[model samples]
Target: MIIRPALATELPALRTLETAAGAPFHDVGMASVAEDEPPALPVLAASLRAGRLLVAYEEGGPDGGLAGYLMWEPVDGATHIEQVSVAPAYAHRRIGQALIDRAGADGGDRPLTLTTFREVPWNAPYYARLGFRPLTDAELTPGLRAIRAHEAELGLDRWPRLCMRREAAG
Candidate 1:
C-alpha cells in the first residue's frame, strides 16, 4: 500500500471509503453511527486543499485504489486528528496507523490528538496501544474542549467519549 496526499478527483471515492468504514459500527451496536452521513464533499475538499487529507492506496487497484484515509488539522499547537477510516476490506492492516504516523511526521514537533469513543475496541483502546493517553476534562485544551462540545451537539455524546494525546515520536 502507498500513502499520499489525497487528490481533488479522489474526494468522492474517499467518501465512499468512509461509508464502508463506518459499517462496522453496526456490529458494535452503534447503528446510528453506522448510518451517519460521511463528511460533506466540500469539507473533505477543504481538508485536501489544506494538505491534511491522506489516503492509502493499493498500487494497482481501480477506483482511485483507496484503501483508507485520515483527516487532521493543526489545533492548539497539536495535530488534531478529525477522522480516520479504513475500509472494512483493509481492516487489521496498519493502514490507519500509517496514516496517523504520516500526519505526525508532517506535523513536526506537535503532538497528535483526537477525540473518540472511550470503550470502543477500535477506538480508545486501539489508540492506547498506539501510545496515546486519555486526558481528563481538566486536561483538555480550549480547542479540544470546543471540538468535544461540537461533538456533543451532534449527538456523539450519546456514547462515552474522551480526548487522547500522543506525543510526537522522538
Candidate 2:
C-alpha cells in the first residue's frame, strides 16, 4: 500500500467514498448532527483546496482507486486530523490506522490532535489505542479554534466531539 497526497482528479472517488462512509451514520442522524446539507463534496473540495487531503491506495492499482483517506491540517505544531474514512468495503483492513500512522510519521517533532464524534466507537477509542487521550477545550489552540469555527458554521454539534491528542514519535 502507498500513502500520498491526493490529486485533483481523485476528488470524485473521494466524494463517493465519503458518502458511502457517512450514510450509515447519517441514517441515524448521528454522523455529524449538522443541519441537512449536501453529502460530502463541498467539504472535500474545501479540504482539497487547502492541500490537506491525503490518500492511501494499493500500489499498482488503478490511478484513481483509493482504499482510504485522511483530511487534516497543521495546528499549533500538531497535525489535526479532521476526518478519516475508508471505503465501506475496505473497513477493518487497517487503512485508517495506516493513514494515521503516516500522519504521525510525517509530523516530524510535532504532536497529533483530532476531534471525533464521542459516541462513535470507531472515533474515540480507536484513536485511544494509538496513544491519543481526550483533551479539554482549553487545550485547543488558535488553529483548532479555526477548525471549530468552520464546524460551527456548518452547524455541526460541538459537544459530541471527543478532542484527542498525542505527542509525535521521533
Candidate 3:
C-alpha cells in the first residue's frame, strides 16, 4: 500500500475504516471498543488540515479506495501517534507498519511516542517488535501524561494502558 496525505473529502471514508479496524477488539473481548465512536469528523478534519493525517491505498488491488490511515501530532518535538487504523480485510499486510515508518521519517530524528492497550496483540507488543520500548512512569513526558489523562477521562482507563517510546535513530 502507498501512504500519502489524506484528501479532505475522504474523512468519512476514514471513519468507516476506523470502524472496521476496531472490530477485531470484539473478537478479543472488547466489544465496547467495537461500539465506540471513531474520532469525530471535526477532529479528523482538523488533523487533516494540520497535515497530521495520512492514508494508505493499494496501488492496483481490489479498488482504489483507502486501506488504512494514521494520524500523529508533533508533541514536544516527537511524533505522537494519536491514532492508526487498518481495515481488517487488509490486516497483516504491514500497512500499519508502513504508516508508522512514514511518521518516523516525517519526525526526522525526534522520538516517536504512543499510548495503547497493554494486552492487545497489535498494540504494545506489536510496537515493541518495531523498536518501541515501554516507558516507565517517570519517563512519561508532560505531553504524554496529558494524553493519558484525556484518555482516562474518556473511559479508556478500563483497560491496561502504557506509554511506549521509540528513540530517535541518530
TM-score of each: 0.96, 0.80, 0.96
Any runs in candidate 2 off by more than 4 Å, and if so which? 27-51, 59-65
Name the candidate, 2 or 3, with the larger TM-score value: 3
> Can you write out model 3's per-residue Cα lDDT over 13-127, one digit (the tens) per residue?
9998898889889989889988999999999999999999999998766535578999999887799999999987788999999999998887799999999999999999999
lDDT of 1 by residue, 1-170 (tens): 89899899888888898898998899989999999999999999999889899999876655546789999999999999999999887789888999999999988998999999999999999999999999998899999999999999999999999999999896
Number of clashing residue pairs, candidate 2: 0
Which consecutive 10 residues in model 1 have the weakest lDDT in total?
Answer: 58-67
What local lDDT score does residue 71 receive in model 3, on the 0 to 100 scale?
A: 93
Residues 35-121, candidate 2, lDDT per residue (tens digit)? 234337777778789877889997554434578889887888898887788877678878999999888877677899987767767
Of 1 and 2, the candidate ahead on TM-score is 1
In model 3, the worst 10-residue window by lDDT is: 58-67
Question: What alpha-carbon RMSD in Å does predicted model 1 have with respect to the real structure?
Answer: 1.1
Positional deviation of residue 124's Cα in model 2 after best superposition, in angstroms: 1.1
Query: How accurate locally is residue 118 in candidate 3, as Cα lDDT from 0 to 100?
Result: 99
Q: How many Å off is the CA of 148 in candidate 3?
A: 0.5
Global lDDT scores for all candidate models: 0.92, 0.77, 0.90
- Full ranking by TM-score: 1, 3, 2
